[model samples]
Target: MRDRIEKRMAEIAVIGLGYIGLPTAIMFANAGFNVTGYEIRKDVVERINSGKAHIVEPDIDDLLRKVIESGKLRATSNPADIREKDVYIICVQTPLREDRTPNLTYLESAVETVAKAMKPGALIVIESTIPPLTTVRMAEFIEELTGLKPGRDFYMVHAPERVMPGRIFRELVYNSRILGGITPESAEIAERLYRSFVKGQVFRTKSTVSEVVKLMENTFRDVNIALANEFAYLAHQYGINVFEAIELANSHPRVKIHVPGIGVGGHCLPKDPHLLVWPARDDFGLIRLAREINDGMPLLAKDLLFEALRTINLPPEKAVVAVLGLAYKGDSDDTRNSPASAFVEAIVDDVAEVRTYDPFVEGTHGSLEEALRGADAVVIATDHTVFRSLDWETLGKLMRNRVLIDGRHVVEMPPEGFVFKGVGRGEY
Candidate 1:
């Protein structure tokens, strides 16, 4: 199996061609493997086959086109097209339920598909972030469906992806990977497979530890951001700039403070913490409280927007609010678990009108001018790089009322003649 993988003779199947799956397939294909991508969305399959990327990421289009033109990658909607592949990499989403439990439906369905299609000696790799013990349970589930004993008839490994959305292609190559196996051989085989393209250090451990490590990494960030948000609230009370305070505090050798924002967003930070604590019997309130703090940040943004309107003597129902940036973060099209969406939801019912403009996201207002024209207030949500250099003095002329609310701290200075209220800029 190692020889076939090293020789690029192992045919690879990547299931679920979303943000993670498509890029993963492209990487493997560009590494000289014959890769097949399976996605239920026919439109996505058609788009990929034609060398176009549905998601926005740096260098994805050029990389995807290279592999597609070389005949190394082919995307398909049919299950038969992926049958009997030597490698199966599942990159499906494991979103949280409405009640905050880890929803494993997508992951399970992908596993069932692989179980039905995989041969006896195929290597199964799950790149989805999931609850601890899920990989072991999944191997048992596959055994029930395929009657193939794991680590005997087949090998299984939990190799969670550790890349951010904007820097996915670059990070996929540079980021250190953690491969957790149910057995020693499973980890060894998966490491060999990824080392073909991965240039960063690779670590091997048990499946459960790998799961905890991924969740812990994100959870740590979430918790620290929550602490930063608390500091933002304190700044509002103390009538100071949290950013300035954080800068000075971070000057201390041991102090490293995270910047406050509207909320934590993206796929991992918001959801992985919940998945980490969901399966545990009992957890101290710290993790859950941190999640609540982060979740409530959008509401804080809403409050700031409404307060700006009140200061301008405008009622909430009469305000035409324009929200700039809808994606979770800057320079990316992904909106899963985005705090911007939550902030919009919080204000959509109260505000007279809400206009959204995100350059990378589709189905938004065509231009920033269009969204701000005649709007009573403008809220900066995503902190896109372009937003940093915006000529606010000129853009303010387009608004009906010059009310600027910086939800993500995009505006460093308050423009003259505008009622500005930023998340941690209490001096405004």
Candidate 2:
């Protein structure tokens, strides 16, 4: 198996070709592997096969086009297209339920599909972030379905992907990977396969430890961000800019502070902390409280908007709000578990009208000027690079009222003649 992987002779099947899966398939294909991408979404499959990507990410279009045109990669919705592959990499999402429980249905379904289609000696890899012990449980489930004993007749490994959305392709090549195998041989084979394209460091360990490490990485950030958000709340009370305070505190060299924002967003930070504590027998109060603090940040942004509205003597029902960006992060269109969506949902019923404009996201206003044309207030959600250099003084002429709310701290200075309120900017 190692020799086949090193020579790029192993046929690879990547299941769930969404954000992670498609890029992964492209990387392997670009690395000289014959890769077939299996996605349940027919539209995504058609798009990929046509050398286009469904999601927006840097360098995805050109790289996907390169692999697709080279005939090294193809995407299919049909299960038969992926049958009896030497390698199966599952990159499905393991989201959280409404009550903050880990939802493993997608992971289980992908594993079941791989079990039904895999050969005896095939190597199976799961790149999804999941609860601890899930890979072990999944190996047993596959054994029950396929009657093939794990580590003997087959090999299984939990290889979690650790890349951000905007820099996915670059990070895929540079980010260090952790391969947690159910057995020692499983980790070794998966490491060799990834080393075909990965230039970063690779480490092997037990499946459960890797799972805990992935979750802990996100949980640590979530907790630190929650601390920063708490400082923002304190800044509101003290009337001092938390950003400046954080900057001054960091001068001490031991006081590194995470930037406080409207909310934590994207797929990982909000959900992984919940998944980390979901299966534990003991209560994890700090982890759960961090999630709660981060989740409530949107409401804090809403409060700032309302305070600005009150200062302008505009009623909430009569105000027209324009939300600048909808995606979870800057320069990417992936909105899974986005705090911008949460903020919009929180104020949708109260506001008279809400206009959204994101350059990368569809189903919003055609242009930023169109969204702000008669709107009373403009709220900057995602801090896209374009927002940093916006000519706010010129654009303010299009508004009914020049009320600016900076949720993501895009505006460093308050433009003249506008009522500006920003998260962590204590002067309201």
Candidate 3:
């Protein structure tokens, strides 16, 4: 199997061509494999097959077109297209339910599809972030479905994606990967497959540890961001700039402080911490508290906007607020679990009118001018780069009143005649 894979003779099927899966499929195809992307969405398949990218990742469209033109990559919604592949890579989403429990429906469905379609000796690798022991349970589930023993009749591994949204393509190749297999042999096989495109180190381990590692990486960030948010609240009460204090504090080589924002958003940070505490028998107090603090940040931002509005004697029901940036983070078009959404939800009913604008997102205002037109207040929710260089004089004229609430602290200072309020900077 290794020899065939190394020789570029292995047929690779990447299931669920999402943010992680599409890039993974493209990279593998670029590395000389015949890659077929298996997607449940027929439109997505059609888009890719026609040389269009469904998701916005930097430089992915050109790469997708190149790979497709080379005949090394194709996308299909049909299950039969992937049945003959030597490797099946599942890149489906593992989102959390409303109660904050891990929702493995997508992962389970992908596993079932692989089990039904896989031939003997085929390898399956899960790139979705899942709860600990899920890979092992999935291996067992596959065995039950196919009547074939793992590590013998077939192989399974957990190699979760560690890339950020905007930099997924670069990170997929450069970031160190964790290849956790149900068995050592399975890990080795999985590592060999990744080595074709991965330029970074691939650490081999047990499936459960790999699962824990992915969870830990995001949980650590969530906790630190929660700490920063706590500090931001304290700074607001004390009338100090949290960003300035954080800068001075981080001058110490050992102390690292993450910047506080409207809240922790995106698919990973908000939900991955919940995965850690969900299955634990005891109360994981810190983890739960961190989640609460981060989750409450959107409301905190809402309060800041209200305070700004109160200063001008404008009630929310009479104010028109424009929310800038809907994506979770900057320079990308991913809106899953976005803090901007939370901010919108918190104030939609209270505000007289609300308009959203994102440079990369659709259904919002095409231009900042349009979003800010006739607005009484503005909230910087996502802090995209385009927001940083706004012409304040022009924007002030476009608004009914100049009330700027910087939720992410992206703006350094407000221009003359504009009332400025930020998350941590009080009366500055």
Candidate 4:
């Protein structure tokens, strides 16, 4: 088993080169292991092969270049090319259905693809963030397809990924990992491999528990954000700055609270909590309460802007609102579930025009200059680092009007004059 694992590590095949897969592949290569990134997108395959990253994760391009230069990393779209490896990790998308059901078609296809090429015994670890029963269900399908039993004919394990898009590499190596397998021995076997790269604890459990762990972690975040957002909404009614009150509460030394943004947005926090909504709907009704509060926050943010505009004596139809930041959060270009998008869509029904600017975004309103040009009010939906460092002097030259709506509370110096407002902070 040790010899077999050594050969597998010497040449590992990473299936589905996505945001999760690419970082995993790069890390394996960074550790001096040979890694083949198998992506379905021909363009993405070519890009990685040439040491260029499609996604904007910190230092990934540099790592990709280093690994490719060392001849330890490569990418290919052809299944025939992917057939020569031992370990295959499925990292394709697992988006939700219209009714918030977990869609596993991508996982199913990748399992079939690997099962066809995979030989007698190769370790297959699933690293997708899926709900309970996903790993077991996929394992059963793979057994039927390959005529192999888990931990006997081959090893099957589920190690759900706990990576933030911007901090993928650092977190993947340093954060605690939860490993689960069909059998006890299978869990041990998988834990040994992961322990090599991860500096943090390697926890072992059943496949179902491992799946649930990811959901629990992300859903907890969503719940906390919702709590903050709910308070922000209530505070608005009383003309109180929620952030100022939160700071006072934090002075108690027992409370550490998350800051309120326009809304909770991200691939994980916005959607993963709902992955279990269908299964636990009957017993766990409070989950629905959390989801409702969070999902409704974007609309609330829009309404707040409209109300603020009205206080200044401007109708929604006559206002020209500009948004700052489209990425889900600060410092990253990944916008899988950005709340700002929803905020724009919500009030656009009545507004004259809505412009947005994110330095991380490649196109659209493209630059900060466009965001401030001919604007009745500017709304800071996300708390990107660049927005915090904006020069008021430069913006003052480009501005058509003032009225800054700064959410996320990251801006230290509120956009000078022009009426600054945030979700939690009443006004400045």
lDDT of 2 by residue, 336-406 (tens): 88888999999999999999999989898999999999899999999999988999888999999999999
Per-residue alpha-carbon lDDT of model 3 for 224-280, expressed as tens digits?
Answer: 999999999999899999999999999999999999989989989999998877767
What does candidate 4's lDDT look like per residue over 1-428, in tens digits? 54555444546788888889999998888776778888889999988888899999889889899999998888998888778466777788888877777788888898888888787667788998787787888778888997888678777788989977788889999999998887787788777666657898899999889888888988888888788888887787788888887889889878877777778777778778877554553656667688888878777667668767877888878888888888888887877778888787887888989988888877758677877887888888888877777786678667665676776776656655666667766543
lDDT of 3: 0.92
Q: What is the TM-score of each candidate against the true structure?
A: 0.98, 0.98, 0.99, 0.94
Q: Write the per-residue lDDT of candidate 1 for residues 303-371, one digit (tens) a residue.
A: 888888989899999999999999888887888888989999999999899999999889999999999
Ten residues in sequence with the least summed lDDT for candidate 1:
328-337
Worst window of 10 by summed lDDT in candidate 2: 329-338
> After TM-score superposition, what is the CA distance of residue 315 in candidate 1 from its true location, in Å?
1.2
TM-score of 2: 0.98
Kindly report which residue pairs in candidate 4 clash with one another. Answer: 403-418
lDDT of each: 0.93, 0.93, 0.92, 0.80
Q: What's the lDDT of the predicted structure labeled candidate 1?
A: 0.93
Off by over 4 Å in 1: none
Instruction: Provide the lowest-lDDT 10-residue window in model 4.
Output: 1-10
Q: What TM-score does structure 3 among the candidates reach? A: 0.99
lDDT of 4: 0.80
